[model samples]
Target: MPLSEFDIIARYFAQATPGREDVVLGIGDDAALIDPPAGQQLVVAIDTLVAGVHFPLETDPYDIGWKALAVNLSDLAAMGAQPAWLTLALTLEHNDDDWLAAFSRGLADLAGEYGIQLVGGDTTRGPLTVTVQVAGYLPPGQALTRKGATPGDEIWVSGTLGDAALGLRIAQGQLQADDSVKATLCRRLNRPEPRLALGIALRDVASSCIDISDGLLADLGHLCAAADCGASLHCADLPLSSAARELMSADSGLGDLPLTGGDDYELCFTAAASRHGAIQSLATQLDCPLSCIGLVEAENDIHCHDPDGQIRNISGHGYRHFNESN
Candidate 1:
């Protein structure tokens, strides 16, 4: 007989990891309890991904589960927060044992890697949707934020941009994807590694930080608005993987993905030029790539510096909830 849902929770989800004493209630409990460290504040974020909406229907169950949790972790990473506990609200149109097994394994792998505990949640019948609510804790006065950037701060992004966007294009068959670039870009899109350690290292160093769920320019613009600053990004300085650029050079429409595509989940942040050396060392230790893409400017005039210092306008090219215009 297949294991019952509750037994599955007890066997897998309830086991405690080392250094995770704060999860007072897990699995069977009506609600999980998290006792955060004293003098620390908790940060929270929630995200939802809908099947056939946010993801292609053919998307792998393992990747779906991994991404659901990873995107939430990226939010915590943005705040330089240590992951605490999570609650899931899962809806399934139909139940399949094999599918659940793969999804569970994927979620467990990522949770174990990050020391995050799965506490309590609701499982119900509906159109496929997964909602994750994550909590993280950070020391007072040191949590990173979007509003801390100043005009003189340097803008930086970790990891290659536009791969996920390109991956989507390939997945949709809008573009033919072959060769090493296709394989690399598809992998990046399928499995994005949230820069949690990078976020921790960036605490007190970066003036502002946000994970790139929206396009880089759009997400960075959010930071600018929150920080009351503007940005001037050099096109040459924006970090693009050879895979992404090569793919894009073949098709110009894909170029907008970096400015408009969503789902890369890398960190977009700003720090003072003085801290670049330290941040560089940290990025190296973490084995994460960090690139200086631009600089914060005085106000809302975002100057995209291409050759000849021309100010290119990248307007309305970001992810929007009601963005049916595309």
Candidate 2:
């Protein structure tokens, strides 16, 4: 006998993550009741992942579950919010007990790590899709945004770029790598770490901030547009993982991936040049790599510069949903 919708919810998701004090009502309720922290502002974000569109059709259920929640958390992180609650709406082609168990486990593990509770959501039968909504809190008037950047502000990014894009290529058989490299890249594509701590620490230090979901160029372009400014990126300063560098050394054409690749999930932010020491200290304390790759410019155009300071024309503006070229 197959499990009913209510049965499935009770068994697989009702107690997936531990309860939170802020959650006055959780899974069994028609709608969750949350008590926001005193004097704090609420931040909510939602993302949808379709099996064939957001991830490969053959991807593991566990990874799909993890990535779905992780992507939404990344949005909250970008806003310098402390995650509090999550709501999941799962759509499955059919019920599979094993698949449900693994998926719930994946979602619960990450939620527990972040001290977030599963609140309320819905389940339905349809094409494989996962939608996750996360709510977080931030001190009133202290959230980071993308509009405060100004000319001469330094541009920075957390961690390396292009690994996820490389991973996608490897997954689709468009690229090849040794076993170790393959695992490293593919793990990045499947399991991305949201930089929540860094985002929180940057509250007053960063003038503007955004995460690198789309490729650096495209996302940075959005940031620039928000601030009504432009930027100049130093090609020599772009960070790359050892795996990406090694692969690029073998195939020079692959060098462009870091500039145009998406799914890095790291934060791209801007701060005054005067805050360099403070930002460096924060990086050391967190032990996370933060690279200053460029400077916001008064000219309203994004430009790329080679090592010797010559202008170079790079193609593409990262991933676009309905651009038709992707």
Candidate 3:
């Protein structure tokens, strides 16, 4: 017997919808009904992943599912929001039961971890693509934004950089790594963690925050543009995992990769210089490494500085979906 669209939804996607108090009506209904929590503003974001573009076409279905949701979660995290609901729009050329099951499991696992309930979604027969729109809640006037940084604010970032970009290189045969390092890097690339707790903690502490989806330079540029300011970033201060450091050590040319690499999903934020101690304490409390990499200044261009204060030229303003690359 051939599986129908209704059958696929009931068997796989329906189970992925976890119970939530906010969801008055979920799957199987014509539409989902959600009740917003009192005294909070909604934070909504949507992201789409297309096979062979955002990810490799042959990637595992499970990882693809996790990543599709994770990227959207990252956007919420950047805004200091708590994820409450999600809706998926999946397009595929064919209905493969095993693939759908595994994908649902992957999506459910992460959604459950974040307390996100899948309220509703759509499925279609087409090229494989996943689009997720996530809604989160945060106190009114407390949500972080790109427009908050001020001159003299300390710029900081959570976790390491360049691992996912390196992973992409390795996956595309542009670079090679040992089995262990490759595994670790690939996991970083496919299964990014959204820094929700950290975002909430920084809600009142940081002046501005953004999750690094595009390369550091590009995303920081966005933040800076929004704040109508510039930043002075030290090349030596970029946080890097041991693996990334090792890779860069082997080839000095790779040093810029961390600065320009994207998909890190780490929070890059700015706060007042006086809040340095508080930020350090928060980092310790969260057990997530946070580094102060630079200072926001009253200028319009991001100035990349070497340790000795010499300006360094950078290339490519990060990845653009519609821009052709040389």
lDDT of 3 by residue, 50-134 (tens): 9999998777888988999999999999999999999999998999888998888889889989888998889889999899999
Ranking according to lDDT, highest score first: 2, 3, 1
Which residue runs of candidate 3 sit more than 4 Å off their true CA positions? none
Global lDDT of each model? 0.83, 0.92, 0.90
Residue-level lDDT tens digits of model 2 in 1-326: 99988998999999889888988989887899989999999999999998888899998888888899899988888899999999999999999999999999889888888988999999999999899999999999999998899999999999999999999999999999999999999999998999999999999999989988889999999889999999999999999999998899999888778888998899999999999999999999999999999999999999999999899778787998988887
- RMSD after Cα superposition, model 1: 2.1
Cα lDDT tens digits for candidate 1, 211-321: 999788779989999977799888877788888888889886665677677889999999999998998898889999999988999978677877678876665657777
Candidate with the greatest TM-score versus the true structure: 2
What TM-score against the true fold does each predicted structure earn?
0.93, 0.98, 0.98
lDDT of 3: 0.90
Report the Cα lDDT for residue 17, model 3. 58
Better of 1 and 2 by TM-score: 2
Question: Order of candidates by TM-score, top first?
Answer: 2, 3, 1
> Highest lDDT: which candidate?
2
